[model samples]
Target chain A: MAVEVVYRSSRDLERLFMDKAEADRHDKMLELAEALASALQNAAPTLSEKQADDLGIFMARHRELFARAFKNNPEALAELPALEKN
Target chain B: MAVEVVYRSSRDLERLFMDKAEADRHDKMLELAEALASALQNAAPTLSEKQADDLGIFMARHRELFARAFKNNPEALAELPALEKN
Candidate 1:
């Protein structure tokens, strides 16, 4: 079955960064981070306490990457919901 | 600034799978895969042909994980746009 792909974007990362590749990587990383967050959140009720803690730690470890991805795109940054203040 | 995280779900993985942790992991992986797909799509216009090829290869490498994630939830699988046939 063909899956419907949705490309949702509020800002253009390529335009914001001088390095287009960097922007691409950052954009991808941010999306991955969000996906990870959603997965964790959705599974929260069923996750064992240890699994939950592990997921939390995983997020904390990668929080910097997420922050960096958003640094130039405050508009996108504003859209991020799981980013915690470091 | 606080980011608004949107958890959009059409099916519950936990309910579909007898193993809840596996379900959580699958859900998370699927989300990550989508995010990766979006990143690649958004950056396509600017990506060097080589970079594009590399990203495609990366997706190919992980496609199994994605397929496994969607094994039970065909609805979620239907939502996936990047899962190429193997």
Candidate 2:
């Protein structure tokens, strides 16, 4: 079998990445997600922990758009795909 | 202002991408997330609509690792970062 080198994010050891940069990026993303979740919980105490986490990760994943949306460009949110309605 | 060209995903007109390929990819990801949310709701009728959408998008974002974990490598999930516990 061919040997392969992979890097694992310290924050998420279950994932293996072919590139160190990618691994670092993944770790940073998770860090941001955690922070966002905490902030969401603090801002809306009524929100369930899972709901906060779900929104946190979702926002973290699309952080660029969110950042823009918050920066005098609320219209940026309209650029986001509409979530499926019940 | 300098002129700029961008691509808008048909399914998500609010967002613009510098690259057509990236816009297409984003669109496809959202499509997958929507389908996943529907399936989740169908399987777990008690889940709130937002919960299902949140989970669907989360899974779609990490589809690679999830696919590996589902394919007899459950340990792969362990590599995922632990979300904050309330």
Best by lDDT: 2
Q: In candidate 1, how many Å is residue A13 off?
A: 28
List pairs with backbone clashes in candidate 2: A14-B79, A78-B14, A79-B14, A79-B15
- The candidates' DockQ values read 0.02, 0.03
- lDDT per residue (tens digit) for residues A1-86 in model 2: 99999999777879999999988877766766676556435433555787666665655555565454333333444555555232
Q: Which ten residues in a row have the lowest lDDT in candidate 1 chain B?
A: B69-78
Candidate 2, residue A33: the lDDT equals 65
Q: Residue-wise lDDT of candidate 1 within B11-66, one digit each (tens)?
A: 34233554656565555544443443344333223333443344334333344433
How close to the true structure is residue A24 of candidate 2, measured as C-alpha lDDT? 80
Kindly report which residue pairs in candidate 1 clash with one another: A80-B3, A81-B3
